[model samples]
Target: MTTRMAAPMSVTTESLAPSRSTETACFHCGLPVPPDAPYAVVIDGRRQPMCCHGCEAVAEAIVAAGLTDFYHHRTTLSRRPEDLIPESLRGLELYDRPDLQKSFVRVDGEHTREAALILEGIVCAACVWLNERHVNALPGVLEFRVNYSTHRARLCWDERQI
Candidate 1:
């Protein structure tokens, strides 16, 4: 049987928040934020708009850590969602453990398994792309896809590879 799972997002750095005069991009990932976008948060005394819930969550996580200064100190754009991830998700190795995988994984068929994960800090389309690439690179991973709207990842892998 096929099973479902969660996924992650990506982020970028910028010097300042966009002014209200034009379309505003997400403060963290630079994705265009619609004026009516509901995902937003206050950071460093400024309210910032986010392109998606994942971006908003990442921004809030950063702010909560007293690391709002990261925006100013970032020397390069974050290449993966993992880069912007807070302390809660510092290690990616948890997924490699059988005990942890049991809760998220299910039998898809003979020699196949599926897992779902909710990636809370995704910030952009590139984040999803990077996550898929990263997960698919795993030796057992046969396919990996992340839904940006739900922050969920659906991973299919060879059971024997575990």
Candidate 2:
């Protein structure tokens, strides 16, 4: 009589292990966050995220002491949502005037022209990235950099195309 060998168990191991945790880094202290350890607060019409209540309180104290730059620098570096601007409804022509002339100073003709734009309502890097992407899509824009602290964007473009 031939003996029947028992079939090997096909048990999957994934069900036995714990589920992966979703964690975000704290904006202020750079700690791993399990929940909403980083609390978002609105200041100067801009939403900012802090690591904890202590950091938030410290931020408030700094603002109360008129140290606005402290907050501005910190908030600018943090990952936050951009303040949406209705570009279609706004007059972009205002930025094209002689006073706001698009010009660049280059020692050699080999260099391209650079222009600085002061964006009024920019709040985060996403806005900067979006604007940069759109502007770069234009025929002549070569490169651009956004300074969140100053809410400004510097663009380099070919003069012939502009």
Candidate 3:
């Protein structure tokens, strides 16, 4: 049986729009606006408070570049600067979940696990060697073997440090 997933809910422009009378947070990232923060960006014919010059610049860039649709359609607000992760790294985070890990990783012992991975973008022997060396250099990795012909790699790692 297939599980049905609900579509992501869209955020309304009104919810993200700044209420000048009582607004105390950055409209772009949802961070608390400092008491004397003078940063703001004009969007949808209204001024929106921003937490910092950084947010103001980014928001202004987005508006100037005609990317305001992101503001209206975002399901969740942006996080604080320190809490934010790079967009490229976010997709790799799914591998950390136990459910996803189960599919590729096999238990070898209490502290050891093995993973069969299919690597992409490999075109030559140097690429395979570079990948093998990089993965094997990790602290808890016990071994890394790769098949250049198939672009497949088997990795053994320690669970506690991995």
TM-score of each: 0.40, 0.36, 0.46
Q: Candidate 1's residue-wise lDDT over 54-140, tens digit each?
A: 677677877777666676666654443756688876777777787887898998899998888788889999999978886787789
Off by over 4 Å in 1: 1-102
lDDT of 1 at 79: 41
Candidate 1 displacement at residue 152 in angstroms: 0.5
Candidate closer to the true structure by lDDT (higher is better), 1 or 3: 3
Candidate 1 vs candidate 2: which has greater lDDT? 1
TM-score ranking of the models: 3, 1, 2
Error of 3 at 64 (Å): 45
Top candidate, metric TM-score: 3
Model 3 per-residue lDDT tens digits across residues 74-120: 87677666567778866897898889999999999888999999988
Query: Which regions of candidate 2 fall more than 4 Å away from where they truly are?
Result: 1-111
lDDT of each: 0.74, 0.56, 0.80
Q: Per-residue lDDT of 61-111 in model 2, one digit per residue for the tens?
A: 655565545433442333322224466746766765655563533322554
- Is 1 or 3 the stronger prediction by TM-score? 3
lDDT of 2 at 108: 24
Model number with the top lDDT:
3
TM-score of 2: 0.36
